[model samples]
Target chain A: MVKGKTLTYGVLLGSICLIGAGIYRNEVNIVLKKAVNLCLECIGIG
Target chain B: MDKRILTQIIATIAMNGNIKGFFEGSIFKGNSKKLCVPGLNCYSCPGALGSCPIGSLQAVIGSIKYNFSFYIIGFMSLMGILFGRLICGWICPFGFIQDLLYKIPLPKIKVNKKANNYLKYLKYVILLVFVILLPMFLVNDVGMSDPYFCKYICPAGTLEGGIPLVLMNESLRDTIGFLFAWKITLLIITIIFSILIYRPFCRYICPLGAFYSLFNPISFYQFKVDKNQCTMCNSCSKKCKMNIEVYKNPNSMECIRCGDCAQICPTKAITKNFSTKNL
Candidate 1:
């Protein structure tokens, strides 16, 4: 049971690390670029 | 009237607070658009303040420059790990819409248990295929790919973003074609199904729900069933819209953590968040 909890927290920490790496890589900029523009496809107008 | 309903309402309003955008037929261009919302709210919804994680993930994955999105995946994983499908129960605008649809004074159709078990796996397939595989592998001439799930399947996008945007903009209305018609058809089908079945989309269609379900057993927020207090009366199971035997599996993947089971447990056997119960 302790092992399972450890694994869960391990994954959580790993996810946070990934988020940090993504931010460093300017991936959030990609999201902002796509989001700021009107996505015609998303609205089914394309 | 319940806390859950209040939370859902507040989440919807807080996430889509740009009311002027709706009136002006424009999308919000705020800094918050860079952040992904935990639940499936369409970013193109005129009033949306944050990006939909699934949509943002697809946007990043489908882009020619980026094959994957560590940020979106990490954000979604963090949300899943912390709350599981409590986001679905208490925050998702689309889920709230389905819940409202199901409340209409119409006869409900309970799916057969044998078929339901198999049907629940479909969303996982959608997450893998439409959201992940197709976008990553199937590219246009320029090596960019479409957000296939958002473009083709997501009824939430159509209902919340597509219809409203098109209605508000004459230029957009002129651009509508078979794809728009098809999306509207899907939206209609989803609405009808929501009335007949409790959260058919969340149960069998939402990729976000499928992704969150993966962490339900291990999430920080969890349900605890006290074996000592339980009466085996199955009141929790009876109250569960997800058809989970709460006493047997308090942390089932299908559980949205709606707290109905905790509320209905006659012996007060069920508890949420932190508990000393073994399972």
Candidate 2:
């Protein structure tokens, strides 16, 4: 019974995080792109 | 069969983009743009399907143009309240690796009981000084980078995330210098020590784990002590890899919700439930 509950919560939380990732995909990409660009800049590549 | 082994296999497949590859034309690029996972897996890792929360936090915090990241914080809070350190035990790929490493033959060191109390606080210090405050304060106009943890400390970023990516990309290999070599060295050291020590990263440094731990006692999923059924056998503590005295406080910051104690308990005393208190 407890195992079932734990599994359910895990699945629910995992799905929420995944869905949130889907929704925020562009923003996250923009930020990472910028960060990577900055890293390249720091290394004198950009 | 060990449940952790099953979890590890599943997580590895999920992380490797096997699941995501089914939906997307290519696994490598599709998941790279997503939000970070709660654990320490790096965003740049070839196999990673999502971003790394700590890396994202550091990137945003360290950014010269941005002052704050509501997205990262909100995501972190969501994970914290929902599962607490359970994420560390169950979801984290690095944690799964550590579990496998500890299974190898070695002289396992049990940390001193008195010293253990003090050591748990180290992660909080790392979070405050290294992760948040330093990045917020240290930057000139150019902005600080990912701070001391990723650059100097995080072996997960070094191992599972760094080495494989660098090895795969020849352009990245050509670009590697002293810093890359240093990180590789740190990774090697961590892998060697992890064979004998249980989660040196989780115990000493992981800021994400530290943040989630603060919510452990009050999280939706928590350990409940029946109090009556406990036989005082100390069996639960003996089985716990996190070195927590489960009976004294099952919802301790050190408790990773691995379910080891619950499964091992002779009397079936420890259980998980929703916390009613604000603690």
Candidate 3:
């Protein structure tokens, strides 16, 4: 039980740190740039 | 209405409800696409309202930066730890489509248990090779790589986005090549196998499912079996589409947490629980 809790907390903390860094690095725009465009290559239309 | 039916409707709609994209021949260019839905819905799908986490991860990593895949990893981590493959059960567009196809009542195919169990590990191999390693190392001179899984493998993107867009736009037909043909063949095979076996892709080939399965052992929400109530009649096992022996290990990686076991347990031996206690 304690182990599961610890693992879960560890994952949560790690996620927070990553998300914080993503924001700091302006990664949301990177994701948005990809997402907003129709990925022609992905759909085999390229 | 069944919980599965209700959630399937909602998830399908949420994933592909961008009405304007259909007439405009454009994918939704919205802020929502910045957010990854916990399913395999293609961001390139004309009607898709959000990004796919796996695709996003591959794209970001392939851009040749060793920077952290923070946004997608965080989102996927939270989802994995919270409900595990419940996302596969209730939210995946392709999984829902497979369920609908399986309802067509074809003579089902069941592989022998030993082989079936061994085959489930193939998805992990796919996750490592296609989604992670290839994109990580197989770069060209420009220090960029392709999303090998998306470009070469993912039938969902081909079916959901490629076919639709090509059908809608005649110009896309000129671009058809060996890659497109291969993806089409894969989609057709997946569609056929989905009818023969329940979630064959999820069971043996889905990289996303592979990632989510990592959390099944320790996820916060899980299916619990009440050993005292179990008569070992095996009704739960029989009803399982994923072929899980639910009464034995309710939290097995093979289980999709679809509640079929709990729904079928004659003595109410299984229940969904949110507690941290071990089963």
For lDDT, the strongest prediction is: 1
Q: B1-279 in candidate 1: lDDT tens per residue?
A: 789989999999999999988888889998999899988999999989999999998998998888888998899999988888899999999999999999999999988899999999999999999999998999999888999999999999998899889989888989999999999999999999999999999999999999999988888888998899999999998888889999999999999999988888888999897422332
Model 1 alpha-carbon miss at residue B134, Å: 0.8
Give residue B110's lDDT in candidate 1 (0 to 100). Answer: 89
Per-residue lDDT of model 2, residues A1-46, tens digit only: 4654565456447646654653454346545563333232122111
Output the number of the TM-score-best candidate: 1
TM-score of 1: 0.98
lDDT of 2: 0.70
Give the higher-DockQ candidate: 1 or 3. 1
Which pairs clash in the backbone of model 3? none
DockQ of each: 0.74, 0.10, 0.67
TM-score of chain A of 2: 0.50
B175-255, model 2: which lDDT tens digit per residue? 777777677777788787788788877887789999888768667788876789998899999998888889998989888
RMSD of 3: 1.4
